[model samples]
Target: MLVSIRVAAEELGVRPETLRRWESQGKIEAPERTPGGKRRYDLAKLRHLAPHKAPSERVTILYARVSTNGQRDDLVRQRALLETFSSANGWPYEVIEDVGSGLNYHKRGLKQLIAQICSGRVGRLVLSHKDRLLRFGSELVFSLCEHFGVEVVIINASENSTFEEDLASDVIEIVTVFSARLYGSRSHKNKQVMDRLREVAKEVSP
Candidate 1:
């Protein structure tokens, strides 16, 4: 069914003049004309037009990550590169950074970005490299992007030392967690000794 220009514009949260202007600019198809030559918008067409955000209007996400705190400088560099890349593409974007293992899914920033992607607010995802997004399951995210009509751009698709670094970091993290657990368990009988042992484990963690 069709609605009058005024009603359609109100429902779409735009002024009637704005809709008319967009129609004249060919940004959207013209609404159907009434017998009296007044414009009326089809509900289906109006809804479809609502999501057609222009490149500048769309939300772009620049995601960057490093495997450890020792690589904070690398995180800064990655954010800078993402900012430059997004600027060159002529779109404003939010930079999301994570300082944790790529193989881990519990990063706060990563979860927030994924929520935005699934919510349909994200129009594009820009990454310096694919592995920068994840170590193994990055394709699952890319598939989600494809399903949501979000474009994925990789500035440097070439594999670098990042993959190996993440592997090493993951190994260290796994070992540390197990060592901590083992130490605590074996020393449960001696509370004072267990506390000191955990402290030493923390000092040795890299």
Candidate 2:
């Protein structure tokens, strides 16, 4: 699908002006111009800016995340499906697995995959669904992929509904933030209790 500069900017979390500047600087290639001189970005161009690499001689990377231990079998199935997809397409593939909450991509395997993408080791990233790869906001991840000239393929039906994904991400962010706060408060209380016990022991000794 073709998108206007404004829509592309919104999807990419960048100012339209910045995209223009990047085009001018040759950091990013300029999109095709319409008869009316409006810029139009194709899926190819947008994927070129993905956090992963464009399909080249390099192998594609498949990232699979299972939210819990019980989903380990699901993770394997995902990997198998990706391998089959790659084989059917005649593409080389590498698989990365993370057994953690999809709420974040900071897991060790995911981090390694990102490192490879940033280093230009992988040509493309394939995920079963946006939510499978992004329980958090995909904007940052997409931006990173784009900056590195990577390509991404979401194998699900919803393609790329940035608005819906953003809403879901906001909810996940709130939960994560609150969970962290609660953990911090509990830690603080535990520290205080330990401190009081130390003081009591010292007073009794004196």
Candidate 3:
């Protein structure tokens, strides 16, 4: 059966505000309201909506990424930290490593992690930091986790900030715009050089 908002909050071990924020962000579906406008949540839905419990039998998945080739060892460090963290917490976990620019989320290791989450094989996703897992933004990752009912734990931040506050779409949009402009300028320069080459070729041919 569904529970009330207050009960859900208690069960989830999060503030009502957090739940409200998740709803606002579309990270999770909004709860159904009663005649009096009180929110109601089903037990199954509550389990799905709630964050992964700190101590649970479910397996936790760790994702670590390094931006450059020099940072390959950094991936190892991240894996170590995740292992230590999980061991210290007595949580059974596995490590998945990806070495690449955080600018793209389509890395092979990331794809495997997402697939596992989508398949409900993972209960929680642990990351070293927002930038490590999401230099692009959190929305895409957040939405993916929310859709699959997986909990996310960013180990770097003790408190949330603007990076944590804004929607993922906004962050990704900014990155996309910057990338487009950079490529567009380069394309323009290349086109100009090609045009000059064509003119020189025509004059020489005559």
**Could you say which candidate leads in TM-score?**
3
* TM-score (C-alpha, index-matched) for candidate 1: 0.56
Identify the candidate with maximal lDDT.
Answer: 1
| Full candidate order by lDDT, most accurate first | 1, 2, 3
The weakest ten consecutive residues by lDDT in model 3 span: 164-173
TM-score, per-candidate, Cα-based: 0.56, 0.56, 0.57
Candidate 3 ranges with C-alpha deviation above 4 Å: 1-18, 21-57, 159-206
39: Cα error in model 2, Å: 9.0
Q: Give each model's clash number.
A: 0, 8, 1
- Candidate 2, residue 5: CA error in Å? 12
Which lDDT tens digits does candidate 2 get at residues 1-206? 88998777655544466579888999777788999999998756665555322546766888888766777889899888888887888878888888766666578987898789788766677888777776766667766766765666667736665665456544544444445545677787755655555455444431
Tens digits of per-residue lDDT for model 1, 4-113: 98777545544455678888899778788878999888877777755432234569899999877888999999999999988987878988889877667889998998
